[model samples]
Target: MNGADVIDIARDAVYTLLIVSGPTMAIGLGVGLLIALFQALTQIQEMTLTFVPKIIAIFLALVLFMPMMGAQMGDLMARLMDRVATGG
Candidate 1:
């Protein structure tokens, strides 16, 4: 592929990655922020406190969003394969 085609594929790959991972990342961020706020208010400096809740939330988010993530990844792969098949 030419430079522009390569760039387009790269952009698509990145976009798909972001779309697939967005929900889990957002859940982790939100849980972490809430934990931080709780720690701040209570003055409990426990490093491991953030880990469990964030992990659980992220895991739940991944499970909940698995189908959408799979669809996004499938679409990306389809586009890529189509490009290859067309000799792009």
Candidate 2:
């Protein structure tokens, strides 16, 4: 592939990664922030408190957004395959 084609593919890959991961990451961030706030307010500064809730929230986010993530990934893969097949 030419430099432009390579750059396009790299851009798409990064975009696809962000799209697939954004929801879970956002959930984790939100949950972590809330847990931190709760700890600050309640003085319950247990490390596990933050970890468990963030994990659960991220898991839930993944479950909820799995279909959209899958579709996005599949679309990206198809586009990549097309590019490969056509010699970019």
The C-alpha RMSD in Å for every predicted model, in order, reads 0.6, 0.8
Per-residue alpha-carbon lDDT of candidate 1 for residues 27-50, written as tens digits (9 for 90 to 100)? 899999999999999999999999
**Which residue segments of model 1 deviate by more than 4 Å?**
none
Per-candidate Cα lDDT values, in order, are 0.94, 0.91
lDDT, model 2: 0.91
In model 1, residue pairs whose N, Cα or C atoms come closer than 3 Å (at least 3 residues apart or on different chains), thus clashing, are none
Worst lDDT 10-window in candidate 2: 47-56
Model 2 regions more than 4 Å off? none
Candidate 2 residue-wise lDDT at 77:
95
Cα lDDT of model 2 by residue, 1-88, tens digit:
7899999999999999999998899889888888899999999978788878887888889889999999999999999999989986
